[model samples]
Target chain A: MMTATRTKNTTTVELEGDRVVVIARTFRAPPRHVFDAWTKPELVARWWAPKSHGVTVKSIDADVEIGGRYRYVLSHGDNEFAFSGEYVEIDRPGRLVYTQVFEAFPDQPTTITVTFEEEDGLTRMVSREVYASAEARTAALESGMESGMRETMDQLDELVAELAAG
Target chain B: MVETFAALAEPNRFRIVELLRSGPRPVNTIGERLALRQPQVSKHLKVLKAAGLVEVEPRAQQRFYALRPEPLRRLDDWLDRYRQLWDERFDAMDEVLEELTQKEDEG
Candidate 1:
């Protein structure tokens, strides 16, 4: 039941019962638009990764229906990373459930549930990732994935700072 | 990093780290406070030491264990990426939604 809130953005990352990481964000867009962005491969390729990473999304094959499969590939400096998932549940513009596995760590599969709720024309998106175990989640953190992401984010921050200073 | 996570994954070891956070303590003292046996506390402390989360110093024939703080700092830095990733993605999504809105308006 540990929760961390970020003031810079309306995102809350919560660790519930040791194995789940729940992230929630509110978008100014309506629910339908938000859902479409999440489900459509072309739209997802635009925002799935931080632009500063310089990683090219090689391909996205998505079947947005129950029992359907999705695979996304990204390439960075001759290195390719792939993630694939199968949809378990789908409720258009409202909820989606899927099982995800990163090719780097195929043994550790995670289940993710995303829900979109509209309030006053704003859409609140909640995503929950449940790992096989607390150790599995910890292992994911130890995989250096966070450091790689942090490096890209730091680069983005430096660019922004330079522009602001100029 | 894997060792650190594996060490802290155990419930007893995790509790031991939480207990040491207030300050350092000897094995007997920690065992007494947590209602654990001396050997049990020592075993947990060994794992924590190997993980670089804690260090032991011999004081008057008693080894006092204290948290190193470096591993925890590394963990915090690692966790920050998760928050940052979502923030950046959502910012991009905002742009996409804005474009969609403009297109609808034009239509």
Candidate 2:
């Protein structure tokens, strides 16, 4: 049943069964605003990649319609990674579904379903990504879905030191 | 997470992980430095790989093994790191949402 649960934080990432990752985060805005932020090309450019990765958003192209395609290109150093997908379903301010394919794994396209709910002026967004198999999920995670994500060697020292103290 | 602990629970595997902290090493080098037989080294490495604790860093000519820092003793620990990557993006989304909310209010 995979019952282990960690202390809740601002965002929750959960593994269900073996092939899906469920991610949820809350925003202090209405669902419409949150939904618009995701659909708008300029807005997606603002948040698709984390700053720590040091990757710049090179370009974003989208049609935002049924079966419409969206592509985001990010560049890190001399390397460029692109995520492109076609819209499966789009229910504005509530639910959206799509397929995402990273250039690294061209053969495997992940189905991602996201929903936004509003409660007391806040919006909670939950997104689930279903992979082709457990192994595919693990590989995507091992590769960090992007580069420059693994922790530093010093963190390894801390992990081992903590184990030795026991 | 339990997988990670089980892989590292073995004294040899734990030492291999510790040895890898310095940098990547070829399989024979791991065997030599850890004072373990080659078969034992391969066995421990297989477990670690399954547990997501280490990976092969193959250079142009040879393959070297290295410690995977993010996938630590706790699976949730790395899950948190992964989600934190999303959190960073969502945090940025927060800014966009804020601007949208402001526009709606003004309109």
Candidate 3:
């Protein structure tokens, strides 16, 4: 019996052989629509990240194919933040595995896997983000990762509704 | 994590906490108000205890459960950060949508 219990939807953020894992889930309209929202740069701009003192994207480039690369730069006036990576696997309208790096702050790239499942026409999207070190994981968590993910999911919901309406 | 939330997520647990917000109450009184069996009330109390959201104190021979409020306060604090993000994003979306609608009207 564990004495300490974490809150709801609080991902088991712990060390995995020197790395950290962050897991989250979001619900949307459909798998294809959610996948498109993630893969398309224009739509990604709408919700790809969060607002930390206000983050505006400088540029976004994404190639949906496996082995393809994607990159984006987020800035707050003079402060800059960049993330770039490549797709290791792409299972059309269902699953995706990609690597991510923060160019402004050099560190090992994180491998992110997203799975989409459809139930009653609503898509359930789950993402597992693996970082290089426990320190890096803690840093990411402290850097508003939870809030960022939640906002992104909210954005996804809006995008889904727009796509469904159109 | 699920266990922590599942404990308090029930409507009966919510009612129990709401009742305790005024002050501590005996387990039997809580069970009566909730129309729940003593064993059932005890189960929910155990969960709330594990979550550190409630505590029991002995007043005479009977035990009284009281609201801690700290865990719920932490939850609100954690959600506040995300709430701000959603509010800002929605504001931006409103602007974009307005512009799109204006363009359609002009066309």
Report clash pairs, candidate 1: none
Q: Write the per-residue lDDT of candidate 1 for residues A89-165, one digit (tens) a residue.
A: 99988998888877656676788899999988889899988887777676554433444535564443332211110
TM-score of each predicted structure versus truth: 0.72, 0.65, 0.51
Candidate 2 TM-score, C-alpha based: 0.65
For model 1, what is the C-alpha lDDT against the true structure?
0.74
lDDT of model 1, residue B18: 97
Q: What are the RMSD figures for all models against the true structure?
A: 8.0, 13.8, 12.9
For each model, chain A TM-score? 0.80, 0.81, 0.72
Point out where model 2 deviates above 4 Å. Answer: A1-9, A145-166, B1-72
Return whichever of 1 and 3 wins on lDDT. Answer: 1
Per-residue lDDT tens digits of candidate 3, residues B1-107?
Answer: 22334455577777887888989988899999889999999988888988887898998998999998887765555434434444454344333433444555599
Ranking by lDDT: 1, 2, 3
lDDT of 2 by residue, B48-78 (tens): 9998899998888878998888767356555
Residues A1-166, candidate 3: write the lDDT tens digits.
Answer: 2357533222222223334343433432457666776677886677544444455667788887888988776655565456788899999789989988766344566778878898886566666677765555444433342434444544433322111101
Off by over 4 Å in 1: A1-22, A30-32, A75-81, A103-108, A117-124, A131-166, B99-107
